[model samples]
Target: MNQAPLPSYAPLAEVVRSGMREGVHYGAVVGLSAEGEVAYARGPVHDAMFPRSSAKPFQALAALRAGAPLEGTSLAIAAGSHGGEDFHAAETERILAAAGLTAEALRCPPAVPGGAAARKAFLAAGRSPERRYMNCSGKHAGMLAACVAQGWSTDDYLDPEHPLQVLVREATEDMCGERIAHTAVDGCGAPQLAVSLVGLARGIQGMRLSPEGSSERTIIEAMSAHPEYVSGTDRIDTELMTRMPGLVSKIGADGVLVLNVPTGETVAVKISDGDAEERARVLVGLTALRGLGVDVAPVKEHLTTPIQGGGRTVGEVRGL
Candidate 1:
């Protein structure tokens, strides 16, 4: 592994408080070199916090590695999360059909997508909420399909010890360059693994380094190709990937963001206090990316700043 310079950051108190001031932050940011070594890291608090959707790529890789058949949109949907748009939902349905599965097989929680129009449509349909509408339904569907392909039990596919989860666990550990020290249930009710910020970055780097036939590489390529499907329009994760060349990013609930830069840089950021206010974790992560000379202005513009009506800047992120 190549050792890179580590930069020190001010306390979260300083980084958290912008010129506007007010709000708290709790999280860590870690950068990894192309060689999968920690370049810089800091966290106000660290434990096995849930990575939420940020873990999707790794989990998808696990499914593929477990013998899942994947295609363009199917692979995209596997790593993706549709915004519950008609197209996204339709694609999800098609994927299920191709796999000889159904929405009944999904295990993700039911919720409207991030889009207001989509949410309205969901409500207007008067259809009961099901796992299919859940953003993670695609991932769940993929997992179940993988089980079918591998002849593994889907009874507890989400269990950490299940064959699929076990493959994911090994892949996760291999990418992180460390063992998983903690685990928690994700928002989607799947097992979530927590690694050091550095470990998370290495895991991302590992995916990039994996061979084309490898599942990790497939997920990375899918996500990179379909950044929009990975996240919705105006979503920070989607915008970041779309605007930045060779970058694939995923943001988890509770202020967690992870990115793999084409230059072989991998980064993860988490906020300790989980303040939804400043989006402090993302600010710190973007700043760190910029500090490391990543061209993230497009991402910073879309994600780090919230615009009021008439495009007025109501609030902007401040961090280093």
Candidate 2:
């Protein structure tokens, strides 16, 4: 196994147990000032990193710009990394139905639901995983709908040179205010763009600050208004959006998260040791919010990660 070279990343969070330092999470997490400058950077802010599902909002915006008739929860699902709950699946299905398509059209691989409870219930009911239950089906569905609406080829919609992808690239560059340095296949089979941590922060900020009727604003509003569709019941995105009204929040796979407040404060975090641990990423995001004077009093319980020991209480991981 190859470990990341030292010095490229600084300590962004720590994993402790029983008053001992068990591990350290090295990564880049940044807070963007209102002027679009990097005010605080824990690591290399401009290093090219995949935005993962964090790119969904802008991708959904691209689909909207292409004339996909997404609105309300439909729009939210399009931009969400849903927990694969029943309602999430229903909305995703609705998008495909409206596109004159069905689950067989989804190219993303089949998988169990992202939510633990949903997966348990699905398995208990003697069902197998399906594409519609995949966490990113909503994103893929939205892209298909856009291709159909624009008369573009839905089969090759994920292709980088496809018409829909061309618009997606344009939308990302336009909103992030930075040229995407590279493109790669996302876990869900969509094209993911590489941009700086600060770029991600600035991009999400645009969602909040863009004109009310613009595509960016529409997606942000939908994500905020229907937080449950954006993620699921009690998930981080849904919980945070509900607690912090007017916040546009999204979490991507492999320890990626972006938080944006209505007041224009924005944060983006990437765990340099990607997939090191899922428990610490949200804590880091909340800590970054504290840097911007956003008091997370309502979410005080989330500030620490509880370490379980044989089903008993143990130590926890807390943001530095």
Candidate 3:
């Protein structure tokens, strides 16, 4: 392992209060990978960090490798943090049904749909949140499917010692090229692994470069083909993948964003303040890609945010 001393974070973006001469908010950016190597890096790349929902792709891949019968939108959702639209919920139900289970089998806490319109409709119908509407339902359903296929008990599938979870840990280790430094319960009640940012980038690159017809490759293709299922309409992940061909992107909670471009470039960014206000994370990631001579013009507008005061545009938050 090429571990190096942790370095201080450098300013990657600045948020200026309206008409202010100085920035009120500052963020740090770390590493960039290309052609299977860490081409650029700053700050501490070896510090343990939780990738959060961004780890879904690897988790879904683990299920597939364990013989879960998932494909197309099902596979995509397995690797997604879906917005819980009607289609997303229905699809979650379908996966559960295919595995001889029900939404009640999911261990994730019940939650309303993440989509604004869907939430309004669900509320209008006098419905309470259900496990099926949880953003992680698809992932949980996939775990159940894998358990059923492997003859593993589904009762405690979310437990770290469960067969399915063991597979997830193994797969994560394989993809990231490092042992997990720590594990903890995720917001969705699944076991989350802590790995270095460099390891996270390596994992994403490994997934992107998986051989054709392999389970990992299947996940990559499924997510790329069904970007909407990976997130939802107007979401950052969905919009980024839709506009950028052959690009794989996932955003974790707390301001972590990872991107894998077609040319074998991988970028991982973390915001120290854990806030993405003004699209700062996206802008920083784009700026890193732009530095590598990647054409980012197509999505630049989408990632740029205008600073406003009293409903009037003032300054703008931009990448440094």
Candidate 4:
């Protein structure tokens, strides 16, 4: 009853250059009303798509359900794609330590810090790429903590067939309110389940609107309360949650974004252009928010990316 049937791909944004259009970013977007019905939708809202990191909130809920004991910054980071700042790294280490584990237990591929400044400082300090610096390390660490809590094997935690991953699958399916159409390995090696944009919007809104003391409410509150840990300092998720009270927002890799307003309005968007940049995504998502009655002007100024021509700012990408 939440989803509205919608059509094929729609043009969500445009690359503008000197008053001329450069190209279009085609994608799907879905919005849910405060009452839980699909308010509006464009593109293929019914088709399966990967939510990527936007799925972290549910993953964190599964961790909690499995007895990870997450709260505050710990819960936020467990559901965040944190920029690898020093504070982010330190917290990740703390999570692993709580379970009597070390960074050596992380199976994610090693990577330098995700932030430009942090990566530069880390390399300057003679630190090599490390698994903890990977943005997904926090999620992996929380999973490990849950595994340890439940006596699940730690070595194959990333395996889809693992008991922890089974919890992940169940949590994801329960939130999205649909069976996963496909299961695939994500960039960080966790299982990625496919759901429609409508389902994503519905799920996020449902979680945000869930009653107090629920796992869903816990995830939303922790994320909103500790936005900096959910992402990192100055990041989009952090900035949005900081600037706007009572909004739960997260950006996913591969042009995915989900936003839930305190009023229960939620929007889920996927930028379909392989060439589309991250900046383009928030702009499109903000447009969806504006349509749902949120005043987006407070955050729209620098959220959209500007185009460069002859070393000067020439254009921008705006949602259609």
Top candidate on lDDT is: 4
| Per-residue lDDT of candidate 1, residues 1-320 (tens digit) | 87433323235433322255554344578777666566666763234455667777778888887778876677777777667776676767777777787777777777776566777777888866666767887788788888989888776888888888888788788776677877788878788887766666667778888877677777888888887677666566676777886788887777677888877777788775565653566667777676566777766563354424455655454553
- lDDT for each residue of candidate 4 in 1-320, tens digit (9 for 90 to 100): 57644336789888899999998888888888899888778888879988999999888988999999788898899999998998888898999999999999999889998766787889999988889989999999999999999999999999999999999889888988998888999999999988888888888888888899988988999899998888877578889888887888899988899999888999998887633357677877888888888887778774467889999999987777
Model 4: CA > 4 A from native:
1-7, 274-276, 302-304
Candidate closer to the true structure by lDDT (higher is better), 1 or 4 = 4
| Every candidate's lDDT | 0.71, 0.86, 0.82, 0.87
Q: Report clash pairs, candidate 4.
A: none
- What is the Å distance of residue 210 in model 2 from its true position? 0.6
- Determine which window of 10 residues in candidate 1 has minimal summed lDDT: 9-18
Candidate 4 local Cα displacement, residue 151, angstroms: 0.7
Q: TM-score of each candidate? A: 0.86, 0.95, 0.93, 0.95
State each model's C-alpha RMSD to the native: 5.3, 2.2, 3.2, 3.6
As for candidate 1, its clashing pairs are 26-271, 26-272, 26-273, 27-270, 27-271, 27-272, 175-203
Say which prediction, candidate 2 or candidate 4, comes out ahead on lDDT. 4
Residue 172's lDDT in candidate 2: 89
Model 1 global lDDT (CA atoms, 0 to 1) = 0.71
